[model samples]
Target: MKRSEFIGEFDLDAVLTELSVDLDIRVTRRMLAGACIGSNPEDAYLSARELRESLEWIHEGENEGKVKLTTILSTACDDFQRCLYYCVAGKGVVTMLDDLVWLEKLLEARGRIAGHIYRNKLPVKPLVNPYVAAEPDGPLGRFDPSFAIGASWSHDPGPDYDSDDRGPGPKLKG
Candidate 1:
């Protein structure tokens, strides 16, 4: 299960500790909180605790099926990289980021998680619609490559989408 969903009700620090234990990674909350672009992190508090709680709620509200090993690796890594954004979100700071550092860290975390999945032989399954960015769409059909929303991603589509936009979504732009 994803950190967001597995323990969404926990705080970011709690969740981070869980992930560190669960995924065998070494990440400092200070670093994670500092990663927040706008979070002052009051004494570097970096509400990792709050993040875990919220994500737990989010995940509990939408947990179902077995999260595929490959899928989890793919998405969890994405989250690890995107962890900074989530931290900001947890801190009630709304901002945008398209950086590669998160991706790299995410990939690294994925590699580590992959080892666990291999040892456990878990099946790849859908957790939920991951956060994706759409491009910018001008007044016309220029399209925003950073669009991150979707339609009916509540469940995977059955071979009807013209493209892999996750769910059956129309032409959308950020």
Candidate 2:
């Protein structure tokens, strides 16, 4: 998305389709944004979409849990957003790289259908894993995951994220 564009302007299905190389899915802008409790609508929607895409491989038949992937992803997005608020509100500091690393572990555990269906539940709280050994894949400076922030995910003085000029990083409360 262009810096000039507001997040509400783009269709979420189109964004997901493009992000996934034209994979057909029925997602609306509101459904995308509805999952987050964050103040920044743009970031919330972006994070939800990314989480959805990451976990979309689980088939309905494989999912024995009452909660859907959408619901699980929504909770995950809320956790992510709460961390963003924490850092932006100056409650604590979590590096963008560390945040990504944390998320990657969540995805790793959740990628297994059995694990996702059995380990995660409704009203899921932020989870911390001790096995995140993967090195962070993106730039380590700011909250710039290409999935969430797009190309302009840097520590530049442009994006107006929750009245904090700094990039939207998350500090997960332990």
Candidate 3:
């Protein structure tokens, strides 16, 4: 994506395809911003196409869940709008955490996914594996792993999450 364009302009598929070539890292639609909840229409559509190109990746297991946030630059509809996006990643796949109300009410999705940000970054660990659950191999190629297969996974949501003296990272309430 160009520095001048809004996130809403491009689809996630297109960006991921271009990004895969540019970053040398495989990007799945599950992580693309527009493909999930509260997504920009354009970005979501583009993501589908990008996913079609690279169809041979598998999910990697994890002790904690991870989600890939698509840079909010493309999802912003206005030229001057900029925002942070949240997503779910685990089991080798990254997708939108649409169910979380954080984005709907203009809240942060990090705390909802994890308990708090007491540790530098809030831990939004998933309870289960959320990977694509499949793979396609290329000649002389390898199958990449994925993450976060479904909504059943999560992080700790107990009293430890709400400690006031947790440090300098962003804090989240249960």
lDDT of 1: 0.31
For 23-77, candidate 2 gives per-residue lDDT tens digits of 2211221222222222233444444344433333221223422133334323422
Residues 25-121, candidate 3: write the lDDT tens digits.
Answer: 2132222323343333333334432322122121233322121222222332321112122232231122223222212322223223222333434
lDDT of every model, 2 decimals: 0.31, 0.31, 0.28
Clashes of 1: 42
* Residue 39 shift from truth in candidate 2, angstroms: 19
lDDT of 1 by residue, 1-174 (tens): 654354323122333334433322212323342343222223113233333333333334423211221222234222433354333232211111111233234334444554465466554332222234322122222223232323322333222212214456452211
Inter-residue clash pairs, candidate 2: none
Residue 58 CA displacement from its true place in model 3, Å: 16
Per-residue error at 156 for model 1, in Å? 42
lDDT of residue 117 for candidate 1: 54
> How does model 3 fare in lDDT?
0.28
Clashes of each: 42, 0, 39
TM-score of predicted model 2?
A: 0.19
Model 3, position 13, has a per-residue lDDT of 31
